[model samples]
Target: MGQTLYPAGCVLDRTGKPVTGFAGMGCEMSSEAIVRAPGAFVPGARYAQHRAEGANQVFVDVDAYGEFYHDYSPDHPMTMMRDRDNRLARLSLGMTHYQLVMGSENATAWSAGVVHYSHGTAQAHVSIVWKVKNDKDRFGGWWPSDRLPLFFKTFTPTEDEARLLFGAADRLPLFDAVFHDSVIASDRWEFGLMKVSGMEGARFARALLYGTPTIWPLDRQEVRRTGPWLKAAHDDFRIAHGWNAPVALTGFRWETADRLVQTTSFADGRTLTANFSSTPFQGLATHCVRVKRPEKAAIDLCPPALPTR
Candidate 1:
């Protein structure tokens, strides 16, 4: 047994002094402390690296988890892999025993099998312009208004920003290829359905291409305002792609300077083709689509019925 029964300890800086923040809020307990003192479980640490130019922080690389490390204190020497395994084992046990569905905030590739759903994988972060223009308060305290702010409702990305934000170069569906059938991935709750207003079409198209669910932060007013479109969008996706079909194959190619086409084939033998070049394929742009199967009739995703607001 350790000297202290309480596993929690003060986090230290490179100089071996406690890392104290405003109102004494920066302290954290390491997993090894629990192991040594309580003989309980370990929880994984976040990824950290040494600052090449700064002396305020010194990095400790553990052998088990590569560059990741726990607190530098001698009493807290647990590796991140051990911690990760311990946490995931608990999750597995809960799922098995309670018939529960597991989910996490933003799941990495290693934790995909354990978590049933995840946010922040599909639409990660917004551009700096969007943040500055919309969220004047950094804490995201601008809710409970009459309607959505004008910037949130109508702000469209410029051509350069569009390419940077929603362009093919950075937008890849690698996560969906492996775990779309098992894990339901969606945008973060903060940036749910109506938040990405001008980029609605591109977001929906990408959701279809990636075979993930859409996240909507709905209120009574929002329901009244966008109800029909939301219903249609959900119905379209449910009908076209069910909740649990694996993506068997995918293809992406550029037909012309402005035109790009992507296809996602599901295990159920349906192939969805998204045409990005029918118009200016920018961040605020929309795409046309056609779904094909061996015996089923061709389904077209065109201008009228799809959600564009």
Candidate 2:
């Protein structure tokens, strides 16, 4: 998992000491997890709550990304996850994505972080945690098939922010909006997943992390399901007997789209029988996105960039 220090410029850590370097990069490839250290350190309080809710929180800073496409390499899929259940009190926003990727070609250490999102608030692997130490650490390699599928992210930004940025945002490069959970967990303290989408956008970004070429076919379709507990928790967060917070869990469903590949776009009304691939806050993110967003697979397998333990 990649990680970095937050606040843009060099900063101090909790120890009151200057951070050793511009940023640190880490990858738990086996588990498909990435964590980067940010300039600003996240408060211990936030980390504590993240541990409680079972939300994946790292001491690293993270950035978000999008997709781009081309021939021989159409699109790659990515998955994202975040702390959407209000597990941590430090961030009091509307489950927005985080890690805006302040600087791409500028940072001395460059940008370091995990890319790809699930658009999901709590789905694990959907918010893909690359850099996993072993096979058990990950759900499995993200590919597309009726038996197995991948997920990646996509989002629709509001007009105001787009105007202020003076750009419509890159279809490939991902900004650390309020939604990227990796950033929220650390409070911009440490962790980085910096890099823009190549010709394939987020798809190519996935190629960078997975260390292999991802192939997205045609229609980009998905299906999703929710755990009973998660359904129970989201509807009534106030119920005492209910889960202390929304918990990340796994479920399955049949899916179809103009494409039949992995994706990070999200929808709430999804059911076990409905079709879905990713979440909203994080959008369609999963290693599978590269594989899922299309209807057919050519059997071209790509390897991870820094496959690690």
Candidate 3:
């Protein structure tokens, strides 16, 4: 599997700082912060928790197949990530935008666009997403006014049960993201900066130059060669979309602005493509997940109550 293994990676600052503090995440006596938001922040927001299908984790490994286990409530959506206190983070983290794009992908009985199905029971789902800034300011809140990024619905995959759902020649949950040193506007591929290093300390750079990993291992010829190639691809994917494509992706190719990444059609309802762009990297980073039975159902998705003032 020359394809890289999927691991949790994060974006780092030039000084190698990984954890970023939200300058306004929890501002006191401020009408601008979401945590202190009026009507937006629910009182005792921490005490409420919700669930579904006898599970609470959004991504559950059931019988080796995955499904979105809901613990969501009228007060909170169980799909987003939780913070230190085992409670939802106050800031509308990436999940907020991710859910908006996934509204159309929900396979649950309640989704509107979904054709109520009769089969292996709409067991799992995945949403392919791309987020960029836009000029829409309608929500009437701080989150809406701060020049929020625009998230587009690239594609959505709802699987019929969870076997053989992965492999070549079909749309797999793993998104194929490519990182180019330019601005990209399509989901066929993504490009971003390489802020994290892999097994070897060979950090891939954001430019066409500085592009080689001189720190190759003394042994293992294949690792030495593939490492740099993989690093460059990861950087481009992150830079273009503010996120990283799945590392284990196979069966996709290079696409670009003029001729960009060509799209691949598959049976599992997922699309794959590559990208080539000419925009420089921005101050953002992202990581994509091949969620099994993703819990993006709108019928039961809502953010938790915001912590009180």
Best by lDDT: 1
Count the clashes in each prediction: 0, 139, 36
Predicted structure 3: lDDT: 0.23
TM-score of each: 0.69, 0.17, 0.18
lDDT of each: 0.55, 0.24, 0.23
lDDT of 2 by residue, 174-262 (tens): 32222222321110101111111211222332322122212222232311221222222223222211223222212222244422232
lDDT of 3 by residue, 31-84 (tens): 112232334343123212222223222321111111222222222223312211
* Total clashes for model 3: 36
Candidate 3 regions with alpha-carbon error over 4 angstroms: 1-44, 47-163, 172-234, 239-309
- Candidate 1 ranges beyond 4 A from true positions: 1-68, 124-156, 168-170, 243-259, 278-286, 302-309
Report RMSD for candidate 3: 23.3
lDDT of 1 at 61: 18
Better of 1 and 3 by TM-score: 1
After aligning candidate 2 to the native by TM-score, how far in Å is the CA of 215 from where it should be?
Answer: 26
lDDT per residue as tens, model 1, 29-145: 443454455443322111111122332221111211122334556556445576566445545543454345556656667666666777766764556545534444432434537
